[model samples]
Target chain A: MPLIDEILDLAGYRREDLYVCLGCKICSSICVLNEIGIEANPRNFIINLIMEKEELRRDPLLKYCTGCYACTFFCPWEIKVPDMVRAARAALLPSHPFEQAFSSSLELFGRVYEPYLLFRLLPYFFRKGYLRLLVKGLPSFRLSLPKRVKTEGIFDREKK
Target chain B: MRYAYYPGCSLKGSAKGLDEGVKKVFSALGDELVEIPDWNCCGAFEFGEKERILALSQANIRKGREVSSEIIAPCPACLKNLREAADSSVSVLHPLEVFSEASFWDRLPMKRDLGGRPFTPYYGCILLRPREFALRVRDPMEEIITRLGGKVVSSQVKAQCCGGNLFFKELEVSERLAKKVWEGASGDIVTFCPLCHLVLKTFSEKGRRVFYLTDLILYVMGEREFL
Candidate 1:
């Protein structure tokens, strides 16, 4: 309940704010993912979550959300739906490889290493004939060091 | 004028063309762009994840501090992230926005001029989001397009997301968004964000061209060929 309240509060959406969802489906109509066979209709999903209908609470379809803010951009209610999606995503980070890698990369290198991630995800591309990208990207593939700034190490320094 | 330049992750890798073009253009304009050493990637597309994004930007700022306080990055994604983490300590600027400034344009060499072709300036997403930033910028794309003797042909998808970070996470979503931009544009598209350029270039149909703002600027300066 605390987490739910936080998620809702972060978006400035209250229990009463749920009534403002006119069911106009404007948010859903504008979502590109919804049109592309992804069941990412914000109207239905938001309503479900707001009503505490636990069925769709943690729908896997949340992964497809790119955090583009399109629904928030187009919504008449001006609801920050993308924020909600990201909050849900943050909660689901333990299971999603891509997101987990994003976090781990930041933890390890202090930034997401694109080439490393690409190499790790090579199977997804190798099967799709994008192996050439690996070859083309080979020249730039290396552990990036901070260009000019030299810190002892991200974690090595004694906590001030 | 001189500023510390932070060329984010892509600049060293896939977007090196942007790195080269910006350096070339800045040099041509009689300005020195000192690259911020040990600069790390600005964590973009980590929407609503302020803590993560801030840490990455702070890591970059700690590097920038070793240089000068005023920093300019060519990518909107980097600029937005850096600006958010920037406190009273430093200034963050996007080169495109810098180029758009009337004072800066006044300083440009009179000899360099790109032809007046009607090209659509795509802001994609990063530049336009947070609404206030967009307003503060006051349509830099149009300003730069006009400065380059080009026409600004805006489209319905002008302010929409180009699915930048999503290109890796979800290809179809990225393709769909890029396709919208491609279809909506009237002529050669010029974008300020390298991430947007990559996505648009990948999904644009044959015969269509997407140029980085630096690409257009360098082409106009006769340092590079048309994009």
Candidate 2:
């Protein structure tokens, strides 16, 4: 549980926040992925973390959490499951190509929707078989990536 | 009143339609929107560290203060991050809120009514959830549309998640969820956030038109956006 403590510190949560989740599955029922039967319940992550199931931290399902906060609002105990999900993510070892692309993009570009950074994630997108959707959606919208407000030093101060 | 504007990267990038519409609608409403100088992206979903998120989001707020004490953000994600990162010194406003207020109703140009086109306001998750930042106006979108002489399709899932949050990480679940939202509505869709617009516009079936709030407002004012 010492490792859990360190991760909690990383995500800025008190240990009681994890203990507050009673496995009610309220968060699961409200989850957008779980609503469509994708099994991306945030409750599962909390339980696994409590059990010290370290291997599950790197699960692809963890990536499905969009941190939408649907669960956080519905939780009776007021547990911030998204925070816990992030805590679990802090422990992830970048096993999946997504883990690499996701972090490196944020670390290097200082933002998520960087158009050029999508190339870095192509390997992950291809692996997830999302290439078709990505390709189809690209042309419908504008890409103001070239004119994006310069965000140079923001990433330098905090190396998360 | 003049207000500082923070068009987060999405509105400037993938969601330029809303960005353009924001300028047009605000001008038509007789207000000026000043872009926050050197405003960076409000990092909520990106920065995992609490301090990092606050630092980044607050930095945008600080820049916003240089222009005005009250700031308006078109993207819900950006609004949420800025609101969460903000303290008592300044206030963050969703453009929808500014447009929905009863006092501002007289200011609507109303060049032409919505022509009775049915519009469903997709408030989406980020805009409504976590409660504090939720729009106080009951049925802001419906009321505005109805007031402007448009029909509104009533649906329970107005605050539903469009899967934009998980869009980059994956698509199947996000796509299905977004489709359910679009198909659930009876007519055209009006969205406040660019991610919501992107998701609803991308996966939605052919012939279904998704409108950003600003875009719809502009159209009603006799300026059809150059779609």
Candidate 3:
């Protein structure tokens, strides 16, 4: 429960947001569960949370969320179901190995390379052809970097 | 009119055409986009996750507040994130929506050479799902396309996701998704999101051209004398 509070604190969302949610099942029905083949019944999870069902919070169903946000799109009430599930999973990360690994990788990728490569050098590399040639020569170094990184000027800015 | 502009990571990088076109189109309509200073990475991928909202969205908002006006975002993901972060408190409008509102659509000069081709309005995932904004773009886009002697084909796949997010994580899924959108349509895809342009262009096996909405605008603007 303390972990739940921590998640809530981090999310800055109130329980009232969840309470406003009506279990209409729109989210589950529209979900791409058939493609992913994972149980992502957002309505059921919300209901369980409302009932204080601690076991539901511990269920493996939370792992299936791709954060695609199909649920939030269809919600008539605009209830933030994905946010709720993310918070719940955040609280249980200690026991959730898969989630822990994923989070760790994300944080690690963001830290080690994103600052220098993505935020800084990538832009310079795109602008200066020599830098791109240099990086290309070092294939191993480039291959080791995160896939999401982008070079600045990949998008053209307005001319001054 | 002037507003704070958050072009997002993609606009600064791979989607330069979008940034250039939007600025040109809006400037022609007497609108100004003041880029926010000292902006940080938008946590582009993680904002939707509850754990990252405060760090991601709030940080953008705090920077946005420095501008003292509603933020006009060129990227749909950035707009969506900022909208979610502001709790809809501030008006987070797409540059196209702004241009359309300023009656820029009415002032659009006709196209000279359409090549008799139709362009599908590719809404991408974020922009299309938000029905209000999608509808807003449709009318203006239609008017512009029609004037260019080009047809605007309405396709279901137009609003589909371009697999931009999945591309890096799952190449197979990305290729399949891109093919779905490409194969599902009959003509070239026109998009507002740069990620969609890059993804569609990469996966297009038939050499289908994906035009950004801004690119089309610039093209039309270039041909204004013909109109």
Score chain A of each prediction against the true chain A by TM-score and list the results: 0.66, 0.65, 0.57
lDDT of 2 by residue, A74-99 (tens): 88876766766665665664445554
Give the per-residue lDDT digits (tens) of candidate 3, residues A1-160.
5544555554566667678877788988876543444556888877777666776665544654544566777889766565666666656654332223333433443222322333333444455443433332221222233434321321121121
For residues B1-227, write the lDDT of model 3, one tens digit per residue. Answer: 77788877566645666777777777777777887664544555443244454355566676777785688887876776676667454666777676556466575554455756788877766765444433345555555566566787866666565566654334455566677788777678887776677677777665567777766667666722321
lDDT score, candidate 1, position B160: 70
Q: Which has the higher lDDT value, candidate number 2 or candidate number 3?
A: 2
Q: Considering lDDT, which of the candidate structures 1 and 3 is the better prediction for this target?
A: 1
- Show the colliding residue pairs in model 2: none
Clashing pairs in 3: A123-A152, A154-B13, A154-B14, A155-B13, A155-B14, A155-B15, A155-B16, A156-B16
Residue B196 accuracy (lDDT) in model 3: 70
Superior by TM-score: candidate 1 or candidate 3: 1
Candidate 2 local lDDT, B83-107, one digit each (tens): 8888898999988788877666788
User: Candidate 1 on B90-139: residue-level lDDT in tens?
Assistant: 88877766676667666666456666788888887667765534325667
The TM-score of candidate 2 is: 0.87
Count of clashing residue pairs in every prediction: 7, 0, 8
lDDT of each: 0.69, 0.73, 0.60
TM-score (C-alpha, index-matched) for candidate 3: 0.69
Best by lDDT: 2
